[model samples]
Target: MTQSATWDYIRGSDKDGYAIAIATNNTVYESREVDPATALGLTFRHAFSLSDNLLLRSSLSAVHDQTWSRRSDALIWRERLDYDIGPLRLFTSVDTKVTTLNERNIFALGSFLPYPESFVTLSVLPGVLYRLSFGEIGVSLTASRTMFRFETDYLGLRRNNDRVQPNLFASATFWGIKVEGSLSYARVTFPAGDFDNLQRLLYTAKATIPLELFRLPIEKLTLELSSGRTLEDTTLPFSVINVSTLSDARLVAKFNPSHALTVFARRKDDEYVGLGARAVTTSLGAEYAYTFDGGLTAIVAGSWRYTQETGNIPVSSLNLQLGLSKRIDFSRTTTADASRATPAAPTTTR
Candidate 1:
């Protein structure tokens, strides 16, 4: 069983902004069979708008027993800078002491995968983004160098022999809908020999239609359908679990019955992989929420899923959760408001 907790303290100034957070968690037995989770951690984020066109961000974190498979400690630090010109923006970042994954859990990486003990990797990315309101149109591209590491032996590879990869990606949005895509290619250099041609390409397109088509008495009922494919050197397009992430179609229906009541429902299914390949399961779920005029709100959510296994695997599970939360904004901080505060007058000495 593992549970985690996190708290964030954010403060911003006219020229710069800052946030501090801490988090930690504990995993009893740290088993892959079933997960009852608990942990606590905090993070601090800071952004500086040196000018209207220039911005910078930095953050750091520390945790214990946080990784899923490994037994260890972890720390992370990240920094990014961005600048905007006209309708285009350029961004780049450097990050270290973070754990992604080692290609074990094929499903959704960790839509629910356990934390392998805390591990860290150093990476750098530089990208550009553009958005034009002439008609709903947006474009984005990001390239990054990923250097993965392991505190212990991972994926049959030792710790010192880190893999290096250069990732390239681009995406765009159309109208109020989104049609974005990405491509990532890697070069794997092992101490043994060299593996050639390690690459992946991903594409996704989603469109949402207004409720005027269905004539439902609700705030919004969006008709959403999306499809994607990942092409790789070894993994066939949309066949392997690792290759076929987010390979599904989904529909969302939301209704605000009254000023204080809201409800939502959704259904999703996996796209067909191939003629003989195994297919992922499907799920249907619903949620109800109540909110008062105040800032407080309560939500209860649950889901029922059907699973299809290859052998004597568990067929499915009925999962449900109920949570209650109350929110109070101790400090309603803003950029403009904080900026308005008078800067300290230059001290004049006699």
Candidate 2:
């Protein structure tokens, strides 16, 4: 069994072009296949529009895992500047990220290390994009490096790694469906040079579509479809392999018969090339909520999931949950200004 909870708090007005957000997630896992453990994560994010044409964003996140005595932290900073050149829009983006991890019991010198090991990675990306009538096209160069912080560098271990990639990417929306694609050429080198250097061409493409765009007859029914594929390389870590491939597809549908009743279903499939793994999962769920006079809401929900993985038999499980929730809003809003505020952009999860 796995349980998780998340909390998010945001301050500042979107209309003012500045906002700060703090969030935390806590999770506990109990299973026969692995030891029971708990993990906690915290995140802080801030976004400020320096002007109508420029934006600055920063985020910091940290996670601690009790099962492995592991701690990980990451910081990301980004800036974007836009300019209108006649009918076309040109934009420049700068992004930087630093990630560090510390863990005990790391195997070294043919034995488990008593002290903790630390690893650090840094990445920088600068890109320029041009907006077209339907979509945008951009090119970027990324440089990333990783280092091991230990007493001595392991001889011939190839623990330190570096990569330089030049990529071309584009995205467009057509007929209410958004599509994105990218092509990259990556060169990976090891400081020790004991391992062979790698050079590969990687390509990825993704598409998303919402069924509501078709104006279906069904009321209060919503459906979404999304699929993505990475052909020669993947976004996975380079510590495992220099090149990998991944593919996935997902579909989700929801129906609300009334204000208090809702039903949802999801189907997903995933494949990994370098890992030689494939999985499929499907689930259906429903929820009902009742609001009391005092503003507290009682909720009941149930779901059944079926999963199958490569070289494993299929398994199915059913879950039922009950909860109570109350929401409190501290911000003040007027109807006229609320109506004129732009809607927040939709987010996608993979």
What is the number of backbone collisions in each predicted candidate, taken in the order shown?
Answer: 34, 0
* lDDT (Cα, tens digit) per residue for candidate 2, span 110-217: 233344435565667777777888998988887877665652332224456688889999999998788888888888777776445767777777777666766655
Residue 212 lDDT in model 1?
55
Report the poorest 10 consecutive residues by lDDT, candidate 2.
Answer: 231-240
lDDT of 1 by residue, 9-86 (tens): 445452476766554444344246644443445567777787889988887866443233223344778888888888
| TM-score list, all predictions | 0.60, 0.64
Clash count, predicted structure 2: 0
Predicted structure 2, TM vs. truth: 0.64
Roughly what TM-score does model 1 have, to 2 decimal places?
A: 0.60
